[model samples]
Target: MTSGKPISSHLLPLDPRRRRSLAWAAGLALLFPLAW
Candidate 1:
């Protein structure tokens, strides 16, 4: 079996999509506070 370090390193390639979704979710959360 592979080591845990290699498994965590593989997740590094997901940065772009993850960052974009995170920004979008943050924006929606901010809008919610204004709407209330």
Candidate 2:
């Protein structure tokens, strides 16, 4: 979609549970690369 949605909207999803899970996943991803 060519809609000009703000990037922050995607970063912070509407679902609280999903947002928390995404934060956890993002943290794990960052840590995984460092632990490699």
Model number with the top TM-score: 2
Give each model's clash number: 0, 0
What C-alpha lDDT do the candidate models reach, one value each? Answer: 0.73, 0.72
Q: Provide TM-scores for the models.
A: 0.53, 0.60
Query: Over all chains combined, what TM-score does candidate 2 have?
Result: 0.60
Q: Extract clashing residue pairs from model 2.
A: none
lDDT score, residue 3, model 1? 59
Q: How accurate is candidate 1 locally (lDDT)?
A: 0.73
Provide the lowest-lDDT 10-residue window in model 2. Answer: 2-11
Tell me the tens digit of each residue's lDDT in model 2 across 1-36.
643255337856567887778678878988999999
**In model 2, how large is the Cα lDDT of residue 36?**
97
Where model 2 places Cα greater than 4 Å from the true spot, the runs are: 1-8, 11-13
